[model samples]
Target chain A: MSRTLFFTSLLYRSTTEHKRAIAEFCSNVKMCRLTEQVVFSDPYKISQYNRWTAPYLDEDAEAVRQDNDLKLEIAELKAKFCERAQALLHGDLHTSSVMVTRDSTRVIDPEFAFYGPMGFDIGAFLANLILAFFAQNGHSNGEDDRKAFKRYICQTIEETWSLFEQKFIALWNEHRDGSGEAYLPGIYNNPKVLQLAQKKYMADLFHDSLGFGAAKMIRRIVGVAHVEDFESISDPGKRAACERKALDFAKLLLKNRRSFVQIGGVVRAMRQVEE
Target chain B: MSRTLFFTSLLYRSTTEHKRAIAEFCSNVKMCRLTEQVVFSDPYKISQYNRWTAPYLDEDAEAVRQDNDLKLEIAELKAKFCERAQALLHGDLHTSSVMVTRDSTRVIDPEFAFYGPMGFDIGAFLANLILAFFAQNGHSNGEDDRKAFKRYICQTIEETWSLFEQKFIALWNEHRDGSGEAYLPGIYNNPKVLQLAQKKYMADLFHDSLGFGAAKMIRRIVGVAHVEDFESISDPGKRAACERKALDFAKLLLKNRRSFVQIGGVVRAMRQVEE
Candidate 1:
């Protein structure tokens, strides 16, 4: 993201050596210990921390606990989350991690930073925006109805993925000759072959992002944590309504991520999700 | 696996509480630093250590170095080998690591042990057997002449996977109620759903084993290390023939591993790969 680059620019200049300083920083084990339970384990199984509107989502929660296929998929994702060290990721890149002003952008609160899939960061931000979209119903008022805000959040999600794809391909083209370990310039020098490889890589990243993003949304609704979008709703019943939609959407995304090839498809699906 | 049980039995008897000891072991970094060149990097690029039946297979080796798709596939496999920690793998599980006595079977030389894909071990063993199969053409004499020996090696490869599948599924069926974190008894308790889950897991494991096995085979023939299968042949031209067939077979297997649904398919392919 441009914001990440802006922040990286500041840090890049501050460093004594401009060398791409690659170090395997030890993950905060306590945080991993906690997240492993909340994100991967607890939500699928019954746990004390899990909560929803009583009587309203009791059966829904029970349904989740009993879903065999869902649990099986989650098991695979959990193993990937715990085991795969794909890249150095911004572990907690929710909308809260970013700030945007007229002329400035910044990323903050990366204390949860560790090696992970790039999608973890992308998914966190997109999933949170989606939460805002769903919660718009609860946030509506007489004068400042959030119908427009809901549309804006969807727009942001759509733009984020489209621009990311265009820019990512452009950057790969620019650096096709550089010393990138994933794709060698000498081997992938042909335009046609390179394009195919890029398509596959980006699709993989998209799926990962969707899966991680769904996990993030699920945790916010039912696990140890709750997001501000749903938390801010005054009426518990209304809050649960918004949270339930988000949870349903998250579960669908986590299970059916590969079915999506385009971000617009996901955005359309987000719009179609019943309130 | 028996050796693992033997070790686990020793450790289990030592303590009552066997913990889920999950640590992202700082991969034997030195070992990785060494293998990256020999297995992944040096063979693709340039290195003094690389040699074949030079002047005989010189063009074949050059073709490998110049092949774009081959390098692309290698890059992916290399990344997976370096990054994905699917399980606690025997890092260097060539035929050399396995030992067989009259009444005792043991796996030795685990100095390079760390967490990795189960396929790495399976692939190593299978690839080495294939190598032995290819080397049969060179190992001929007036004696046994390896006709039955070749059949025996292929049989071993087939039984290794078939027996592994049978025993693995049976164990899963028996311990479907046990405290395995990968699949919970509460959710995947039923037979139909459990069978479906087992099928998917085994298929994935088979593909990984094939891919990793192919990588191991390629590295042995074309990289710095030469297997005794080819090295034992006194005739350089004859050795080149054996090595080339092995290398060609490895390439096909690595790129098209997913097409194989069963080990018998691979064995049949092995039988087809002529001397």
Candidate 2:
């Protein structure tokens, strides 16, 4: 008997609370075969589904309508991307919502967790981490130390995506109710076929990841909740410059999200940013 | 027989390597009596005066112009505002640069530390902490814990600013050099006049502090180094919404900075912001 528990809170909950809730939730999940709703569709439930929430309706009715329209378009695109990609989706994947304790890796906050486009979760998680990494300078000194921290983050991005893909594929192969649908049976199991398929999937994921990553990065730097790293820098000019760089990086990545065919390309693009 | 050290760092000497060299540099400042060239000049040379630096320019063109422009502006502003305010400055004041060890509370990162706006440092430090308080939600959680954390932050802001002002005024009263034409001897020091003067000075400082405080708050949320508090939020929409509120609060404060002639106004504005 497996019980599947749903994670409730994300923003207000601390890491320890997050961990505890996840453990309990997982225990419940193991006991029940409940299909947790990761993404909320009901307009009334939008607040419950997202971390950084805003009322769906803004002060201006027209502006609110426009924003909603934009969201709908994005959703349509997301659905399209998922359909085209035809891959195992983690549904809602982002690091803050994820919890692990030694032996088993369990996802706690699954308000939006689902199976659709695996790239969405992978991309969102990596993008957010990168944003945090660039902002780390505001909080600490020691250039060498900052560098070490960045290296750790970059490695995590690569490793997490790599491991997730490995696990997802393994799960799919083992549990796949073979239907000979759009995907080839066991093509991922073949060395040459698997390599080609992996490359293509990675390319698609990288592109989507870059787009969402840019959006997340841009919104944070200029949108709201500006990082403390720049806050610690007393010079307003220097702070402004750092912010400009982050925004620039975001715009570049978002605009070229689809053009990225490999993970190396994305890295190279990010590296080219002067800041 | 007595050695007095100013915690402020000289502008030029401040670098990544020299981040930890301020304590040593203070000793050099006292021993060398480097004030003539380092403290007051048409253009001060801090980094160049140190033996470790290589010659980059025969003269820093921008610094010379900046010094001339800033000096004139300060002198004019001082003469105007002096009627209602005190003259003392803390060039660079913010958290992460300030260190506290047991009984000692001294500012460390003061490369830009100078005397201009007395409230700038105080306001900046408080603003940084406030941002951090909100950001803590990204990692930790407990309903009561969050409530307690917020209360502690609010108290810290109130107390720290109050204490800083009291200490600053006390220092000013003790060390006021009577050489300046602005000082009319007993005209200001007379007990009856002194009370009125203190009231006015406090009012002006409080107003200026609010403006700077608002700027620090707004920029951190909308500027460069974005906070992690919202990132910790698993729900994307909610996180974004909360951040929007923070930004909105910052913008309001900045726009209404000039209106903050009374400290009560500043406090009221902050309290008015709905989160």
Candidate 3:
């Protein structure tokens, strides 16, 4: 799912001129402020636009508001989302923004597009996938239970992150000697040092992705907007159950993302959450 | 020294529109790239423009190039300098950029002004002061030794950071209910949460100031441009000794800035480096 977004990010070379041009272009969009308002702030506060399975999840939503630790973590993530211009991101890369037709996939609706942390795009896509994974239970019937489909979603989530990491490192190695400004070739050219740099970069990116993915999940469940995965479930009780599980996992992820070092661990934790 | 810069930053309320306008203005400056090159990149690598007191400190210059850990920390700082756009900065806030008189003080030479981490401006001014403190020995004589002057400089350094923190937080508290985008009153209105948020914000800024201050100090010693503090010393040995002391302190601060929690501790550390 993130392949196209990552490829689009790689299209521009990381020369000084390229970075300045991209940053200039991104500055005009005002997407950073928009994302901070919608994704990070509104959901955590008492906003009129916020909605949920009201009677069922009222306390849950209030818990999100009152979670001081959660609010603090979200503030830090919001700061990063606003401050770090790591790359060009598809500012709203949810499942609806993507169209998959077996052989090819196309991402659309870039009105929110701007320069931001790459993890936002990656995390957005993955969060939607996790939402679908959790909602599979709500859609399940007697004969066609979605246990297998849930596993498939989990696998897709893991593969998306692992593949993105592999390809990103490959691209970095290919351009290690280029005019990229992030890590100069002269300083990081030593193979051992290069390895260390890559490890640190990927680790940081992983944590960022988890933090963003969880925030995206929390916002969807409680903020003004929501996803069809849970909405499509006719039964509100079942839908709330699925959302509560997802919300629990997201709260945990947002608070303790750094403790998670790999995609597999996240998947495992997702499966362990009670529905 | 930073009074004007901080005041200028506070002039614009952090409304969404105001932030967008400032960010747009800053994006066009390209000062971020220039600082990255001169302050963070060029000195650590082999560059024709890089020079020092040559044979007098040839080994020390080479040691800077050989320190892998230093290179790694610098890369992180450079990334922050490039990526984080926290506030408007007088991009080149060194000593020469200011003009002071008995009645009033004026800041000039803002060719490098842009939206950047506030610490860059704060650190540049403080780092220049530190360099002056280290260079006092070279200018000392029997009739007028600079020991008392050095102590005065140390007090000034401590007061500069402490006062900045006090004033900045005062501004934040005064405008807590304003429409600022960084920390909304709805979410952070509680006294306890507000205190936590302020503590976190100031602590991060303090560390950033130290890191940037150290980087600025380092570039003056080994990068293309040398500072008048060390450059004016007539004796090569004396100049190298002062430069070496400043360089040693800077390297330590750069690598271990987070371990320092207070400005007083940093002032003490600056005094401990052997001259």
Candidate 4:
């Protein structure tokens, strides 16, 4: 089957093998009559990221280093999560994967999607938010505009998680009975059993989500294709200052991700600044 | 030799042994001899990080997923840099490290010091500046003050590198003759070779500085102790916004550290808001 892989050049570089695996997996998931088809899985064709064509998007040298570091971190997290729970993963998901048109918000590229862990998808989206903020900084011409942009991005991340969680729970609750019995049968039977199972599942998701989110956030800093917010600074010293800010955020996010249950906790953590 | 180790509550429990080795090596450098003499290098004083001392900082459950991902990424970066540079490093060195009681700036707190890579120290200090900016969202008390603080941090990182390069070179220039050949029948000549050797040595230093700096920046954000900038938002959505800004910075710093040479490159980099 022809399969496509979608990834951010700034964050990931996939091999032919990686792309094929994702394509094959997506094909399996799409063919699974038991799972819901609301989220369509399709292999997207990708054009090479030609540095010459994208002049302004030149990979900042420092940003590349940040990306390299970030990639290693993501690999570690993935290994840890795999060891903890053998859940399948969506592989990658974020604004880069989503497409918005007037009234619809659709999940587009599923090339990197797989059955690794549910939390991975959630974290990917959230991590992109951190990426987006810096990306926008280059375009934020005024202080007020920059502040507004910052607020918007933060709010979006919080809302996205809230929305995703609520939606996921709603699906789980609705499919509790024999309606969609093909995939999950006695999994949701008996109230007490269901409660215990659900809690454990949720807990797993929480831990995985936190870990995955951190990986995504930290990789951008030290991985190969560092973000523009710090790179575009034209002055090495100023860029270094910008990088320091990003590092602080990475520290806090990884440290506190587990404790943050409500959206407010996440918000509180993000608002912190270095003293 | 008597050695002392202090512990930080990092995600990964670090037992610094090689750090002692590096410290010993640095101590042996006659030109840069330490005033605080260590009588012995006993392994008994090695301290372990108290992993359970703090509560899970992620107050918001949803954000946990994102933070966890960041944690992995940070870990990876630190590992890569330490592995590549031959970890015998002075862990932390920033504006704070330059203890300025009056007009003089003296380096302090080699307590966190270990043998990793020289870049880790330089990068850690520089990365903190960007941390201050994003952390300003939560960590900084006032908006205007945060702005000023950010500016100062950025400037300091720039100046630190510039001054450091000059000082490092000056030190090499003055001390390379090996005590002027004891009984000099002619003018001393070894010093010139020592000075010449510095060029090659300094090039390696520059590379390490960039890589370690990238690691330092990523760890602060995604490691166990999350920064306050993103933590203080009270709204998960808002907080993530601040985090995004920080991540952007990390990406840039890590990517460009290698290519940049002078303070000017760093300053220009920090000033850039976008790609």
Candidate 5:
């Protein structure tokens, strides 16, 4: 997902051409408003479509509605989601959106694609992966506990973020002298200043990813649409328990995402919530 | 100018209507990109179009180019100017863009109008008033020092900001139950939470206006177009002295805009720069 976004970020409007072409590309799709309503808005409020494992998760869903701090954080994210056209995005990158084999990986269903924050796509993939990890307990039996599988998911989460950060920075360095309008070569060409800019850019992106990831997680659990990972659990009790863990961690992450400096902290927190 | 923006903010896309209409209106105009280039980007860099009172402001213009902190701050403002579609802006709201009489005030020449941060328009008007205040000395002779008129200009700057804040918030309170997408009625209906949300929104807008205002001032002096307030001075030395003061204050405001909480403090700072 990060690799996909790396290529997307490279496709910017050239300084010589008409900027309206790119601006129209972003606005014409209406993807920003769509994401704002579904991923950021409808979930937190009393929307007619919102549902969860009724009775089991009813209180949890109501609690989300009542949480003012969470609502405040979500509003900020919603504004950023609507405003920041950082790069082209997959728009709806979740577990089912990808096809993977032993050697190759392909992403599908880019109908929602538009120019938006790169973290949105990255966060969507991570959120689905975390949901899958939590749902493993429901699939576990006496013969197969799925403990090792959960650990593998955790490792994959960490690796995906680490690799994404490395590749994204490498691409930026490669294109430092390019025609990107955000950072001009004449001003940011100095190595020290370039480093400062990159540090600030990456830090902001990391927090955005975490915050969006948590929002995705919360919506799946208590919002209009439930993920198949939790739905496939069959037993409502077990499913609700797994969802509650994910929900707890997501709320914590969304409220205090800035306190998290790295991906490792997030994975460890996920583990702590599972216990 | 603020009253113009208050009305502009009222025109928003209804949730039931096609958002594409408003989105296209913004992108088609390409006002955001134009402002980003002229007001935010061109002034900070060595553009061919850029000019100043040559020989006199040679070092000052060079210092503007060399200030790494100023460049960094400008980059953030450029990104915001390009991204945040907060409301419909007058776009180029400098003093010349307005027509005023004893009985009526009318804003003209909205050719650059589009959906953007409200601060850009507010800042443009305020920046022009500040420039007019600074250029008063150059316009003065022994008999008419223009001291009273200078104070009047400062008073206008202060009143414009104060009135804008009050009227804008009053409109928000009146429309608390409206279809505005930024603050949902369900989530922000509580008096305490609504107050918090308004405070945060206004504060952010205030800082954004100051940053954009400072950028507008800098470009007028050092970028492609020079404001007539200074240009009308005729004597290059007098014009340069007035410009240098405006430029210095603009740089300070741009870099430290967040530290300012009220318009009164800003007016005081402007007077201090005159001394």
Candidate 6:
């Protein structure tokens, strides 16, 4: 009965049909099809679409399929992808989703928008940055110029999570007495319990974000999709080294996200891995 | 594109409206109003709808709100309720949901059916059994013993999960070569990996089931709804004692479901708590 108008630099194109489409075309379709196959399905098994640095990653990809514990971890993440509806997400938010300059940033082309885990959004953003970090070596021509850029990416990852946590907690505190039923004002209104509730909430979200982020990173290397950062490395031999590092770190992140209590620990691990 | 006819004991209403209705009316409608409160919300906060046996359960209910870990556990379960769509759950599966004859039993009115965690269904069934176990003392009169009936309920609970596990694994094994993407035939088709996958899946499911079952038990004790199992007991004091035992066991189950690997441990715990 009502019409709404909008003016913007981007057309996100949110479909009300998103959920049903996600359910219907999950095993098929376009971009969501990418998430369905690469992130959720193909990485766990030998699929024709799945490729790596070929001769280099043959064992790695096969190991992923064969490692029971690793496969178990991926299986849990896959279930979360299929089952949980925690938010409306930009399912593929790798380096391509953002248009950023010195002064402004615009997120565009969210054709994959659907109700998914909030962590998927957070993870995609963070994981892409991690991919950029891992791809740094492939970009090098025996120069340290990109060192500052790598540091900047790490700083951004750290600050992004830090600011996100602060803002999320602040909002929860502001709305503690509001209509939000997650932490009811009548029960968890007490300061100690309220803080405890927030801690656990953040901890779980952090782990989920890391896990999803890791999955995103792994898929780009081994699954059908390839990020330009590593793809443009030209020499398949050199690119394989950079990708192997990313894949290794991603596997670590996916399996051990629960052990990471803070963003700093993750950053430190990334730095150590890069070294 | 196609026409389908249905005539059966069950109605699978394939509605495009299922998700929205499930999300919107979750804690706010019909008999499901009970689930919205007891299992998902009220137990976390002090609400007018939440009532325990006044003099007996006052401290216990207060302790529940005060208990940080317990509240966190409940919140995680609530998140799963809000987020996870692991199966087509028969949501309101209390004692009231079941109808029995000598040989044939038919389950009627799956009005709360939706895509939800399988544990919620299993938990609801198991929790109702626990409720019956607790209520036996309240139903005790001076004359004949109801010990056999209580034993029967416990045996039923024990047999239920055991048979469910056996059948589920059997199905998984038979269908390991099918189109299921969770464990691909090429990778997880191996005997050792398939067995490992099943073991992990069942273990995780067992924990989830216990957590959900415990949540159901707690809500019945303190949330908006009271079951006929406890309601049939005329004496308040006796009912309170029975309810208190149930409440204690439920808290334990919710908090420590992971420590229990087998159904036998849960049965023993129930008996120990009763003692």
The top-ranked prediction according to TM-score is 3
Q: How would you encode candidate 4's per-residue C-alpha lDDT over B16-121 as one tens digit per residue? A: 2322233243332221111011100000011131111123322322232233232233323332332222334444565456666677757776554533335555
Model 4 residue A236 CA deviation (Å) reads 4.7
Every model's DockQ = 0.30, 0.01, 0.46, 0.01, 0.39, 0.36
In angstroms, give how far residue B79 of model 5 lies from its true place.
1.7
Pick by lDDT: 2 or 3, better one: 3
* Ten contiguous residues minimizing lDDT sum, candidate 5 chain A: A10-19
lDDT of 6 by residue, A1-275 (tens): 00000000001112122233334333322555457667867887879888898897889888878777777787677667655765556677666788989999777876776556667778988998999998888889778978999999999999888888886676566656654444556667678877887788789889999999998898889898888888889888889999988988999999899999999999999989888
- Model 2, residue A224: C-alpha shift (Å): 58
Q: What is the TM-score of chain A alone in each candidate?
A: 0.88, 0.57, 0.93, 0.62, 0.92, 0.86
Off by over 4 Å in 3: A1-34, A141-144, B1-15, B22-31, B142-144
**Whole-model lDDT per candidate:** 0.71, 0.42, 0.80, 0.43, 0.80, 0.74
Error of 6 at A241 (Å): 1.5
User: Which regions of candidate 5 deviate over 4 angstroms?
Assistant: A1-11, A15-34, A137-146, B1-11, B15-18, B26-34, B139-146, B234-238
Instruction: After superposing candidate 2 on the true structure, give the runs of residues whose Cα lies further than 4 Å from its correct spot.
Output: A1-275, B1-90, B136-142, B175-181, B227-236, B258-271
Q: Provide the TM-score for each candidate, comma-separated.
A: 0.84, 0.33, 0.93, 0.36, 0.90, 0.87
**Residue A263 shift from truth in candidate 5, angstroms:** 2.0
- Sorting all predicted structures by DockQ, with the top scorer first, yields 3, 5, 6, 1, 4, 2
> Per-residue lDDT of B17-54 in model 3, one digit per residue for the tens?
54464556554546666777789888888888889997
lDDT of 1 at B232: 86
Candidate 5 residue pairs in backbone clash: none
Q: Residue A161, candidate 3: how far off, in angstroms?
A: 0.9
Q: Write the per-residue lDDT of candidate 3 for residues A52-78, one digit (tens) a residue.
A: 987899999999988888878887887
| DockQ preference between candidates 2 and 5, better one | 5
TM-score of chain B of 6: 0.86
lDDT tens digits, residues B160-217, model 5? 8888889888887876677667777877758887787778878888999999999999
DockQ of 2: 0.01
